[model samples]
Target: MIYYETLSINDAGTTNNYITIRGAIDIGHNGKVIIDGQNTRSNCIVIEQGCGSLVRDWIYVKNLYLRRAAAEAFYIHCNVNNVVIDSLDIRENGLEGIKIIGNDDYYLTENGICAENIEIKNCTIISKSNNLYHEDNCVYVQMAAGLNIHHNYIHQRNKQIGVPPGQHEHVDPLQTHVIRDVKIWNNVFIIDSSVLGHGMILGIQSRPGRRDTVIIYNNYIYAGGHLNPGGNPYINGFVLRWYGYVNSVYPPTYVINNTVVTSNGGENTILQEYAGKFYNNIICQLGTNGQNPANYGGTPLETFASSWNMDKTYVDSVRSNLMWRQWTNDMSFGGNRWVGSGGSPTGIINGGWNVWTNSNWGGTGINADPLFVNNVRERYGYVIASNSPARNAGEDLQAFIESKGLPWADIEGKPRNNTPDIGAFEYENQIPVEFTSFSATYYSDKVTLEWMTATEINNHGFKIQRKLGDSEWKEIGFVEGRGTITEQTEYSYIDDIISIQTSVLAYRLMQIDLDGSFEYSDVVEVEILPAKFDLSQNYPNPFNPSTTIRFSLPKETRLKINIYNMLGELIETIAEGTYEAGYHKVTFDALSLPSGVYIYRFESDSFVQVKKMILLR
Candidate 1:
């Protein structure tokens, strides 16, 4: 309770105990409640083995910055059911950021006393280890069931400060033991393959003859590999090893709709026993162009091969998994084949979305570009394009998932259509604008909402709605929309949000139909954050004297934006003034300037940026 603003502990009658800890900073205030361990404490917060292990349940911790812990930032010993850790910013921790200790001996939770539910969400954990030790992760569980981890950002940093250069060991976003009934979804893990063991190693210890499923879906894994060329540090992506004997009682594990970009020329997924259904995943070997030089009609790009692996004993049901230009791998359980035109069984099957390995099992899947929105192997850029071949190419798993009573949703929390896409994100292929994507960016003084459309029907325009904090929504502005179109279109709106100051701002688009009907887009929330000085390149670089130059200021700082010639000669001072801390843009008109390459520099107190602009006079 030391770093908490308010602590609420309510007795839940008989089973009574609900503990809540939150940041002390005022909601919407300009600061965070950071707990600096200074490498002194074993853990910032600990629910040790005996203190409340018998009665501790329903504990909620949120919105706190925790750093520099001697060991773990948050440690839960023994077992604590209904535990939730949310919105925690953890960095520079000596060990794991969030560590939970449980045991799975003979399938019993440490003395047969099992915890019911534990959840971690919306937490950003980076650099859990300062490279001092080789082992680190955002979250670690010795053994835990009924665990739900979602909507979190984990950046596994391999930099050890103040420590001598040596080999970092086993850097993973998560490391678990005897995982069962675990659901991990909607999370982004930035994995840097800067260590010896560069992937997750789950020791599935003793096989309990029972049916328990670990569901993994809608996750994005971006690897920081292939940087160090001389060494083979980019070793593996996911390695799941089961130590005990194989048992069929362990029902089906569900890994669905995940987008994973592995370190180039590395194994993507290696499961000791993939006794599950692997469906609708885009697991790409970075820079792989799927041309096996030794095989027929192969064009080698990079020396990349091997994608996914599994055991033949515990065969899996894999379908609609997109392999991006990856040459080949064992991809076990069945034989692998290419997508080409030839014989009946060798050619296209199931809409060319799968290469059925066996008669009963109908999917090893297809290989294509997926046509991602970002089109590059970058973070959070895995969303499929409007016209991506992946759209609606996945096999229907509604019957299977519905039987298991699972919640089917995309990476962005959107419900999937009947014909789903073959990746983490489902295309926003609904009516109105057929909005593929809608996002909001926060500037110091304003917020900008942008959306795209695959196609639109009966769309009159969009009515922008704004909400401050938890207040009621109000129509802020309206932008004209393309009534009806089949082509892709993008639209943007800027909200002058600074005029009325509030800590949080939410915005959404209401697509007004020409027939007077309307539909609402998903709400996007933005918070006021400290600003930094930034300069953007001018639009229409090769322009006839007119282009917009945008820049940002953290404070009311004076700026001098001047034009210079190629020979370091001054041309024109297009803008010079003290501007507020917000999004501002200036129009540069070179009406009289000659056609040549010109340098434009934004000079301020400690910030200076120069870029070239071609002016055709």
Candidate 2:
């Protein structure tokens, strides 16, 4: 029951793990099970499954508000093939918010291999670790076959309050080891001051013949830049190093369309020893590095990211990146060439970076202020302005990532224009209304549309549209939107269908601004269940002279009601009519019948149903 009540899963995935349930959760491997704390605190919640006994279920954990755990918030070591952990608020966990590890029995055949299609998504985790020299992580997965870590906001508040003076902790938002297929996207990694917090630490050794695919994209990493001009050590970004367990040729890691910015430009903002696929990224480094931390302003530190070995591949070709800062460099058309600031390349044209690396690699990169909607100097202000240089200045990523039907939308689920924008956000410059959610549901032969807006500016109202099957959309009704408000406002509209012609209906909303500027929301669809053809028991069964019986029909048909006696003889013909596909009622008057048990038979098309009633007068 909690499994079906927890998740609203509709699609039948390729894995066929989604099973529709209306009963208690007994089919373990078929549906989702939620261990919701109802927003209560917990010491910890452990979902551990040994290799000797694997459930291989579709496990999902969500809606939990866990904080201040003794160790980690959730110690999940499930052998389930796919595990989705989302929408949990984990705070001040001792070490990690979620920790996934396996035992030494990796190749156990008790159930099957522990190959995980794990997804740690849509969760907010914060750790205020006061460890002096210990390392901490928001998510640490050791042995997942394919991991999708996306849409999470992780903040490591390494405040260093309880620690001794002149000592700091180490923190990482995401750290994965030995993950074969790893995808980290659409996450905000906020690192607190006084600690060396890296955005992602992806460690995986090279496979002999098969490639270990790793993709990192569409993330906004705020490496610490408290701007104290006194404290806050350097904040690190992408540490893509594999441990030397099986050293071979490095697999191509695709780092594309990410916005990596630092408040305090510390050491190794983006560091990778080997060559990888880098394309259409925006690296903004504020202030300078260690020793001399003078240039705290938004000046271009061309030496911020260090990727010594860079190349152009299917995922990295046609690189057109943007760097938001003032830089002095010579422009030359070269692919993935890293050079120093205020200089030209002294090496080969196609040779990767020369150790120190560069900022002017000449792949459609403009070294100027990437005017964000808010001030770029702000720690995490990332969305570019309408007049920003980052707008429509990068590569077309929709075709690149969606050719294989991958999830390739911006951070806000906006579609990419032909010429996409740089950074994590695709610049649409949508003013007025920012909708949080909009949905439609069918009830009582009517479609009720509901929506909520996070913030509204110069908003007018919403024009509701409806359609059936492949028909054109028609304006159904309108709900007035909040004029201009910062608080979240919810709106709903009920469309009473006069006729139920189709079993499915689609609805959309056109949110018009006060100044005639308008934007359309995503279309929502609902399937209307057919009305059952049945007769309800008569109300006031033991009546003085009259009783009422209601019947529902699935389709238009002729119906008749007859009164019968206990001997099965017809006493009276009460009603007869051709009724439509809806509910109908009829009154049976037993004024002339004797005070005894009477039977009523309802005959429609070829079916007859009988019900006994008492007439006492």
Candidate 3:
């Protein structure tokens, strides 16, 4: 049986008090329920006790207008299990709009109650009035065994409420909590934190014990704060305090792939409680409000992100995370489109394992302007058109794919192809850019690089260049021509011969067309002096913890390099690959190991080079 409730619909003579829904209340034939509160009253329909019959149950509530209530306007208690809520708009309520307390009232009186399998997604929970506790929150849950909370937009206006002017003020803000096997994924938490008070804090006296496994992944936390004179924000990251006298032993939680940005003040320590693994999270706190900063400490690993763009004053004490590079004044992650562009400190830093060439949702992570559809509203859900870099760059939630109960792998309702575009949406017929074919040869005077295009329209020619020294790129030349309309078009360029004294001369194509169109060709080099391939001394030689090593390949060869301790038992394999003829660099971090002289060697093709480096404490 399907159950639909609208607080507005009622006969004039009939007085409806509490709408008790029994049996299975599946939504429409499409398995969705729509609940609009505009025409209704009292906010929500209460579920009386003894409703769980192990039947198929799903709750779809939307367009909710909570009018008056002291606590949660929409409360679902009793023996309810397996409930899913979506498109829920419970705004402008007197109190918390939605509360899913998973426990049997009868069982609470007798033996005990068990909270099981509940999911609340794509909902907007907010307040209507200026009263602090009156218009406090949208949703609140407790004693939940397993829950999935994702893609909900939570907003709070720091309006003063309650009695008196300043006394009894809500200094610390409240947040959505998960008790047990809970997963908070891809949700937005906007808390107006200031220098005067604390921001979002989780956990209560009846905390989810130390044995519960909670997973908070891919969520965005936007706290209102600013950068201090020294770069730290004057706010706490997240506070988890236990209230009950006897604390429950909780298991380690997993917090990964999250982006936390502070607006007004500096951010303090992350998570006051323990038991969690925080990985691949992007944390940035700028602006100052004269607050002492804090650092993250645990067995957690900071892979692919260093303290990029953070002030050194705060980073000096907590630069232990594996960063793509050292701490810089800004978060200008190189190779991304937002490298040098000003405003909205969104950029990437090239260092650590977090950098990637392809957008495969892999890093070489850039702080690019995600060109959101409704940026101001932060409905980052929609990516605009074809050129958006965020196209198909969304990471596939492995669990989402597995639990879909569908045969097709394209869950999120996407196309199933070899390499899906990274991110959320996938494009079917994006314009294709191809290099086709190319050839290069070196003569006694100069090296000539040429290539042919089989098909082209708004063809952009190629960009030709050569690299010799540190990060300095010299644009040697550019080729201008129309790619073949129907027939093939040929183009060529010659770098007039210079003394072939150097070990190598690199040549690559920079294709450009008439309409300022272009693309870079792969960097292919020609070696004049085939020196025995050796590993040069690591740069930033007197390094404190990490450094880069530059090596060359005379020919196509297989390479292997391993780091060793004083005893020489192969500490780790730094590099092992089939490298082409060119100078390439790789980094080695000595963060985890002891500080001492470490020996490393390289062997490729038929050449070998051994070197030693000192890692200072």
Top TM-score prediction, candidate number: 1
User: Could you give candidate 3's per-residue lDDT for residues 215-260 as a string of tens digits?
Assistant: 5555555554333232222345444443233444444455544545
Candidate 2, residue 568: Cα displacement in angstroms equals 99
Could you give the candidate ranking by lDDT, starting with the highest?
1, 2, 3
lDDT of each: 0.64, 0.64, 0.48
Query: Which candidate number maximizes lDDT?
Result: 1
Off by over 4 Å in 2: 1-43, 51-57, 78-80, 103-115, 129-133, 161-167, 227-232, 288-292, 295-303, 307-318, 326-364, 375-380, 434-617
TM-score of 2: 0.57
How many clashing residue pairs appear in each of the predictions shown?
5, 9, 67
Better of 2 and 3 by lDDT: 2
What are the per-model C-alpha RMSD values against the true structure?
A: 16.1, 17.9, 26.6
lDDT of 2 by residue, 501-532 (tens): 55568999999865466888998888665566
Candidates 1 and 2 compared: the better one by TM-score is 1
Per-residue accuracy of model 1 over 1-617 as CA lDDT, tens digit each: 33532122332212365577778655565577777777887777776544242556778788888888888888876556688888899898888888887643434432354444788998998874344555777788765667788888887766333333365466677777665567787887776654344344454533256666667778876654433333333434454554343442454567788777654443434333444566788866553234433333222222112123332322234557876644554322222322222222432123222334554333456666666545333445566666777788887776765565555777666777678888777766456567889988887577889999998754679999999767899999999877545678999998886555444678899997654557999988876543677788888889996998888766678889998989999878988888766567789888887899988999998689988889886
From the highest TM-score down, the ranking of the candidates is: 1, 2, 3
TM agreement with the true structure for every prediction: 0.59, 0.57, 0.42
Give the Å error, residue 265, model 3: 1.7
After superposition, candidate 1 runs with Cα above 4 Å error: 1-16, 24-30, 51-54, 104-116, 128-133, 159-168, 197-207, 243-251, 288-316, 326-362, 375-378, 399-406, 429-617
